[model samples]
Target: MKKLLIIAVMALSFGTYAQVDPTFEKEGDKVKATYFHANGEIAQQGYFLNEKLEGEWKMFNENGDKIAMGNYENGIKTGKWLFWEGDVQKEVNFDNNRIASVNNAKTKSPVVIN
Candidate 1:
């Protein structure tokens, strides 16, 4: 029906612009940030120092599944980061904010297509 079509169009339009601001909380010397997706689900969670990204960060998909996790020092990437890709996991090492080495390992995990 025409009414059904109009309602569907409106829903899609709203979804296209469904942005929500991230919430921040103070924790000791760092500010904890929780970023959300359009559906109000947590997209990423991390800490910030001096208004810059600091410490460990975890990224999730819309379904609340972790897709990536890593660490940062004074906003610079550092340490090990894990990323899920299909049935494999990419383990990356960082030094000086750059890739130091990469190793691929097999794992059964849920994957989200962006």
Candidate 2:
């Protein structure tokens, strides 16, 4: 599920590069990264540990609107992830790098899989 989701996102976002250079900073044992969009807006910001994504990460649109927010553990998706799609917000729960459940906030309906 995770792989499929990633591939779909990649396919959808064909222009996913920033013209400006990205910046990175060291925060104790972790490194903080801030990526920019082509128009210089912050695309995403997150922390990495030992070259792997760790802790909370946030994604934003070119106009500076936050589009998604989630957490990672040892580079793997974990816990609840929220994504904004048009007028709706989608919540996905992940366990062991796999989706456990998904809820559409606007519809108030949840889709769960064992």
Candidate 3:
């Protein structure tokens, strides 16, 4: 009896930990966003179409600043991607999962004197 009870408890615990959360997906007419995380901070966020990433996507830093933005088509990156670090910004051109060029500001753009 004790051995059977122990086996049941272990099965329950394993089942709980192995469960996977469902991702966002379009239902009928509305689109949804899904978040992937670690340590309670958002690691990735994007629209989900049929449980796959589709359309524009934005990634944020732990402090919540916009870190990167790009377009996604059928869960694959398409078009251009922009990345930023502090005052520096870089633009990367992408073609069919390949990076074509990267342009970075050699010197910071001057503030507009209004």
Candidate 4:
């Protein structure tokens, strides 16, 4: 019906603008991304290049606190990375572009607090 056609056109137009251009390699490749909490205190953003995460990435908690930060090389996590959950600070090691180990701060009594 004519009404159905109109609705379909409207939907298609909206979808086209709602998505980010994730395909940065070849021209005219469709790519999409979603950003969280744009106006809220906490904001998180990420992107997909050619449908793969191929750059720096960041994440934050609802309270506007940084939760994690790292990079993606060809969609694989690589290089130094840091992760924070609540009050805990963790340092992660990577090898061959993969996570090797994670080190967290140790808690100690007053006598050994360093």
List lDDT for all candidates, in order: 0.92, 0.91, 0.73, 0.66
Each candidate structure's TM-score, on Cα atoms with residue i matched to residue i, is 0.80, 0.75, 0.62, 0.53
* Lowest lDDT 10-residue stretch of candidate 3: 34-43
Best prediction by TM-score? 1
lDDT of 3 by residue, 36-82 (tens): 44334554667767656777888878677778999887777788898
Clash pairs detected, candidate 1: none
Regions of candidate 4 where Cα sits further than 4 Å from its true position: 1-34, 37-43, 105-114
Q: What is the lDDT of residue 82 in candidate 4?
A: 81
What TM-score would candidate 4 get against the native?
0.53
Global lDDT of model 4: 0.66
By lDDT, who's the top model here?
1
Q: Return the number of clashes found in candidate 1.
A: 0
Query: Which residue pairs in candidate 2 have backbone atoms (N, alpha carbon, C) closer than 3 angstroms, thus clashing?
Result: none
Taking the tens digit of each residue's C-alpha lDDT, what string does model 2 give over 39-86? Answer: 898999999998999999999998998899999999999999999966
Clashes of each: 0, 0, 0, 0
Question: In model 2, where is the ten-residue run with the lowest total lDDT?
Answer: 11-20
Arrange candidates, best lDDT first. 1, 2, 3, 4
Tell me which residue pairs clash in candidate 4: none
